[model samples]
Each structure stands twice: as structure tokens, then as C-alpha cells.
Target: MMTPLGYSIMQALAGPVFPLDMANFFLWVTALYLGGIQAIALMVHSKWLKRTAETFLTLGTVFTFIFFYFYLNLRILSSHLYEAGELGYMGLIHALSMKNLVPAFIEFASPLQHIFFMFGALMFGLFQISDKIKQISLKTRLDSVYAVVAPPCPGEELRKAVGKGERRDVAILYADLWNFTPIAEKEGPTATMGLLNRYYALWDIVVRRNHGNIDQFVGDSVIAVFGLIGEKDACETAVACALDFLKEFPSLQADLADRRLPLVKHIGIGVHAGKVAIGELSAASGQPRVAVIGETVNTAARLDSLCREFKQELLISQTAYKPLSLEMQSHFQPMGEVLVRGKNQLQAVYGRK
Candidate 1:
């Protein structure tokens, strides 16, 4: 944006301007600026686009002299000394015939200045492209972490809040695939892992479809979060995803059997909704990981563990239950208050047998 006008002003100061040269200069300047802006637009899209821009610009810069070399050769071939009969009449005729093969070059007042300008442009493009690519890479990595573990948010918004803790109200789902250890020990390690792979694949589809984040997977357990992490609230979708997993459990088992994975159909889920502080937490290695930390998150996982004692497949705490839509409220049955092992008070747990 700053180049053409500056050059034009300097040129005007250095010499008398002719009407024809001024017109040509203006046209070329316009074309240069327009093309530059458009290229920048394409380069901003992704790392792929940025690399493509850098490659094209660098190649053009690197080969700038090669283009001039070809032009010089073409001019020599077209205007040979053969025309003066130094070689022969035939050579002169051949050199004259080669005139059509000569390519025109864009004339510059000073070749050194032209090269300097091109070098400067190349560096400008590279610096811009490199900086943009870094931003994109960092954003994509952060987004993947949030989508997988923490709540989903816009990349720009997330960047503005990085490392800074902020409270969010969300619904957390903790699901454990039960009886897998028995199957693994009975059927051997290979079949057990195969089952887990297929089982997790099944659950991933449902969770993503429900816009729920699969926060962490430990061994055979899956932790999912619903609520503001997605379009719907935790109370609305968290319980639904749990129920869907149970509803689809038998069918998945049958599919696993067909694949010779093993017969195992045990999944326990706990749903709770409350406030959590979301941010990046660094480990001893100084490696940072995005985390959702709060009592609500712990309570949800605890409820999932409670399923082992109650012999129930799905459970929801009052935090998630009370906010349930009327139609949803009808789907769950009250299990009364239960003394959770780590809790100070009896938790009012609800279950769907």
C-alpha cells in the first residue's frame, strides 16, 4: 500500500514527467496494488494457503534474474551480427526469423532499484505469511484441545482469554464402560482392545452429534461435557446423550459380536451441571493443557462411579435434574438421597433403570 505512491513521488521529483509515461505508471501501479491485496486475502485463510503464497512469491523472487537471462538471450538471438554478414546471409536470415521468439521485458528506470524493490516485497510477503501461519497453527491446536476436553468457543475469543481463568456454567457427563476388564482377561488383550476401539467409535458419533465434548478418556471410561460447550444446555443434552448410549448399547454389542470382538454391554453414566473454571494448566514440564476444574466436574464423575453400587446404567444429580424440561423430567425416576462416599451430605440422585 505504501510503495507505489512513494515511488511515484520520488520519480516526479527526479525528472520531468511525460504524459505517456505518467499514464503507464498509474496503470501499472493500480494493477500491482490490486493483485497484492487479493494475494494477501488468499494467504490469510490457512497454513496451506500461507505456504502456497510463500512458495509462489519466493520462487518468483529467486527466479527474477533467470527471467532477465532468457530475455537477454532472446534479444541477442534476434539481433545477431549475422545481419551485418559477419557469419553469412543464411545466419542473418535465421537470426531475423528468430525475432518472433523474443519475449518483451518490463522496462525499469534502474535495474538495481527494481531488484531491491522485489527483494523487499519478497521479505514483506514472507514475514506476513509466516506470522499469519503461526497464528493459525496456534489457534487450531488450542481449538482441538477445547473441542476434545474443554468447552468449545471461538478461536479469537479463546485466544483473548488464554491462561486466564474464567468461570463457566456447564453440564459434565462421566461415562464408564463397565465389565471390560473381565472381557479383556477372559478373551485376551487383543480382543479387549478391539472392543474398546469399536465401543469408543460408537460413542464418539453420539457425543459429537449431540455437540458434547469428550473431555478425557481414561482406560475404558469416557468423560463428556455438555451445556454451553454447545448449542444446547447440559441439562437438555447431557442426560439425553447418556440415555442414547444405553439405548444403543445392545445394538453395539450385537455389532461387536458379529465382528468377534466379545459380548460386553455395560456402560454407566453420571450427569451434573454447575460452575467450572476453565483455563490452561501447566504441568511440571511446563507443558500446558486446557482444563475444566471445579466441584461440579468431580461430582459428575463420582456419580458415574456410584452407578457401580446402584446397578444402574444412567444417573443424574439434582443440579442437572432440576433444570430439565418438563418432558425430560418425566423420563427420570427419583432414587431418593444417597450417601456418596466422599461427600459430606446425602446427594439427591435420580436414575433411569
Candidate 2:
């Protein structure tokens, strides 16, 4: 693409050996460098883009460098034809057929080519290093946030989570500590946060041990998911997880007492089976967070709220309850159909204390 400009450039440089055309080559180099710079400048702030921007810039730099090399070579080829009294399209064909072109490549690949190669490599390194740092930072943040035990996922599974409407039938588990507002108001922010963290840390162990993912953490509440992975029945896994949590309740309270903090207890849990889409999330300019979306998540949260009203420590939707093992079902009481928040129709839910 730069051939015509290179041809004009070659003409002026022939007399002075190093002249106006050399200066023009520098300008061409600047243009290629700036193209990469502008693209990175625009996309560097996004997490998704930051992950890919270096690759994109690297490709652009490589292609540009390739085109420039061919353009300069063709420019030199054009000059040979002019000297031989061959001109225009036919002249180009004749010049290309000639065997004398090999020596010209080494002649042109001097200080300018070396400089361009170094600068382009330098720019690529900068983009790649920046991208890697962001990746490490985001992974660290996710480690703290997701802090749940889940089966190892192939690289593609996480990629799927970033896509829109990537839905599947997964079990949702929503749990929240009882009377969080009162506790926070009584103990102040620091103590409340400490308590919340401790509670979640314990629950994190339960969910991870049960093969579930903590889809998200809302203030005083955690929304976990089962069947996003593993071959186990979603409902079965969810019930087992909840049962484990409830059975561990007394032990958790005892541990708190040992720490000499307020002896507190009780968290409500609601389980529902349905579809969930791992909603793709955007990064804040400084902070990045992922979001979970779909009606199933909402239904699970609503079920958790109703647990307090039903005076039960665990409440599960009819859909989830149906899939429970016969032995497990025997322990649950039928709470009947009740209106759930954000739904136009009443939903049948069961309870266990």
C-alpha cells in the first residue's frame, strides 16, 4: 500500500544517499507505531479488551511491518526499471522478472529497519506486560470473591460465562444471615463486616465441599449455584449442602463463643432449580466485578426471604423439592403454595427447620 509513496521517496534519496526519503521512512514508521498506540489507548481500560488488546496491537504491528517491507522493496524495484528505460505497468513486470533484486534487500535493511523492528517489539512488549498484570490482578480478585470449592473448569467454561445468554438448568441456593440489619446497627460497621466475613468464610467451605459455586455475594446474603458443573443431581447436591450447613450450625456457634465474640446464630437458606445465565460483566475503570443474572436467581432470593415468614431455617421451591431423594423428602414439611416476590403467580415451596 505504501509502494507509490515509497517510489517517490526513492527518487529523492538516490542523489544524497541518505536524504528526504530517509526522513519520509521515519514518518511512515511513526504512522504504523501510532496506529497501534491509538488502538491500545482506546481499549486498554476494559478488562475484556485489556486481555485481547496486546494480541490485536501485535498483529497490527506485524502486518504493518510486513507491508512496509514489501512496499520498500517494490519501491526499489520501480527505481531499477526507470534506470533501464522501462516504464509503467510493463516496466514493473520486467523489474520483477530480473535477478538483480536480491542484493537490494540487504542494502535497505540497515539502521532504519533495525530501528523499526526494535521499536515495534518494544511497543508489543509494553502492551503484553500490561495485559498480563491486569490478568493476574483480576484473577486474584476473583479468588477472594469466588472463594468456593468447585471442580476445575476447562478454559472454555469461563469463556462461556462471559458470553450473553449462556444459560443452562442449574440449581440456585440463596442464603442470608438472620437479622443482619439489627446486628450491624448494634455492633457498628467494623464488627458487622467481621461477622459477615466469618459467616461467609464458613459457608464457603460448605458450598465448595458440596460441589457448588458461590455465584455472588450480596450484602448479608450469598447466592450459590449447583449443577453449573458436576454430574450429581442439582437438587440432591443443594439439599445435601443445606443440610450440612444446618447440621453444622451448633458447631459454628460454639466456635464463635471460643473467639469471645457475641454468641450469634442462624442463617436462612432457600434452594430452587432452574436456568441461569452467567451474565457478562464490565470492568469499572479501576475495579472489575462479574454479575450473575436470570429469573432463577431472583426466585432463589425471594425464597430465602420467605424462609423467615415460614419460620423455617430452610425453604426450597417445589421444583427443587421434587428432585430430592425419597429419604430426604421424608424430612421436609409441605409449606404449600405461596406468592413469591417479583412473580405474578403463587409458587409451591417446602420447608425444613
Candidate 3:
């Protein structure tokens, strides 16, 4: 549209005798080529292809601008050559083909064009490579963070509740590794950390399989919550997870022994169900960490601590026990009321026999 409009205007001013020169033709072609390349660069979704197209466009613009500048200036400074028409587009092309014989063609195609083009190309390539590296690094960091944090809850509403503070009844499961301290001390930091990671990895599988979310790992303990997203039988699910943990422990220990790492003899798990405040707590790193806090969490931790004294691998409070199916309930026997520290009333605890 602009091409026809410009031609019409030029004809109106020059009485239909407007000269069609090689420079005008070249300018029109260059503009269309650059415009087409820019459109393709914008349309492509692939990062690599988009960058390649953009680099090509940049190089084309730089080289075209340099060539046109020299071409037009040469025409103006040497009118005799233009009048003879030896410096027309085709003539210049012929000169370039025989550039070794024609020194003036060398001036038209200077070393400065190559220098600028190569510098632009190099910087564009470096910037693209740097962006790609940064993207990969960020992805790795986020993967590690997600592995350590709780798995995302299913629904958007539930996720929002967890992010903001909300009172929800959830079955809290606290599992602590038995005899880990001595093993850590004997095995040293690096080996002990590896072993601990293995144990936590196993725990993560069991908890997720039972539809529970692991909130955090504090030292040798893992705190997980079931039904935070409103599962009806959260208590039964928590008890089932504890049982699965016990069932999987022997295999884990055997694997550790095979690897020649320090072995953990047992794991103590406690499950309690009640209302708890679910919210995000700001860490020292200024990131928000999802936290479940209340008396129920404290009770569950205490019950886990009592596992050694009670000679049981799994323990559950009365609140957790009441909601279980009869078959699941039969797996435990009441250990009677015991006054746990930091509680006014004697809490009824049940131990898995």
C-alpha cells in the first residue's frame, strides 16, 4: 500500500517521469526482507528459532545500512561515475565479482562492515546462550525446592487455604527415626546426611501413596498431614500410612546395610486428628513455608516420643483412633490414659501391637 502511494505521489510531483533507480529498488527489497524476517521471528514459538531469526535480522539490517551508506555517498561524491552509469546496482555487482581487479569495489565493500557484523553476531549469540543457561539453572533449583516441600494440594481452594491461615481438621503424622543421633555422630555428616535422605525418600513415597502431604523434614523427623484437602477418612489414611512405613522399614534398613551406611533400627510414628492452623510461615530466607501448627501437632510429636517407652512402632491418640474402621482399629490396642508433658489432662493413647 505504501509502495503504490509513494509512487503515485512521486508521479504527481515529477509529471509521470520519475526515474526508477537501482538504489530505490534495493531499498524497497531490503525493507520487505527485513519486515518478513521480523514477522517470522515474532510468529515462531521455539526459543532457538526465534533467536536465530532475530540474529539474522540484526545482521541484515547492519550490513544493508552500511552498504547503502557507502553506495549513496559514492554516487554523490563521484557524479561522473553515476552519469556514465558504471556504478549502477548491476555494475557494482560485476565490480564485486572482479573485486581483485577493481580497487574501487573494495572501498564499497569495506572491512568495517565485516567487523561490525561479526561483533553484533557474537554479542547476540552470547546473550542467547546466557539466557538458556540461566533458565536451566532456575529449573534445577525449583525442582530441588519442590522435592523438599509439600506436594501441591489438589484443588485451587485447598491450596489457597494452605497459603493463607485456615482452621481445618487434619490427621497429623509425625515420624522420627530411632537411634539416628548415635549413627550420625559415628558415621559423620556426609554419610549420615545421605542415609537420612534415603530414609526421607522412602517416607515421601509412603506418605504420598496414602494421600498425605509431607509438610517438612525437621532433623530426623518427617511431619506429614492427611486430609488437609478434605478427605473424609483422614484418620484411617494416617494409620494406614504408619503401617506402610513399618512394613517398608526393614527393606530400607537392609538396603542401607548393603550400601555400608549406618543402619537405623526402627522408626517411631504418631498419628493424631484434630483442628490445626494451616498457614505459611516466613523463613529466614524470606520465603513462605507452609506450616501446620496447633495442640494436635504437639500431641502427635509427644506420642511419637513415647513410642520407645511404650515399646511400640506406631502410636495413635484417641481422637485419631475413633474415626478408623473396625478392621483398622483392631490393629491397635488401647494403652490407656497417660499424662504427657505440656498437657493438663491425661491423654488416651493407643499402641499398635
Models 1 onward score TM values of 0.51, 0.52, 0.55
Off by over 4 Å in 1: 1-164, 228-232, 281-289, 340-344
Model 1 — TM-score against the truth?
A: 0.51
Cα deviation in Å at residue 140, candidate 3? 25
Q: What lDDT is reached at residue 346 by model 1?
A: 85
Worst 10 residues of 2 by lDDT: 146-155
Question: How many Å off is the CA of 51 in candidate 1?
Answer: 47
> For residues 29-73, could you state the per-residue lDDT of candidate 3 as single tens digits?
777888888899768766567667766776676556655665555
Best by lDDT: 3
Between candidates 1 and 3, name the one with more favorable TM-score: 3
Q: Considering TM-score, where higher is better, how would the candidates rank from best to worst?
A: 3, 2, 1
* 111-155: candidate 1 lDDT, tens digit per residue: 777667656666776776676555555544433332223322334
Ranking 1 against 3 by lDDT, winner: 3
Sort the predicted structures by lDDT, highest score first.
Answer: 3, 2, 1
lDDT of 1 at 208: 76
Candidates in order have lDDT scores of: 0.66, 0.68, 0.75
lDDT value for model 3: 0.75
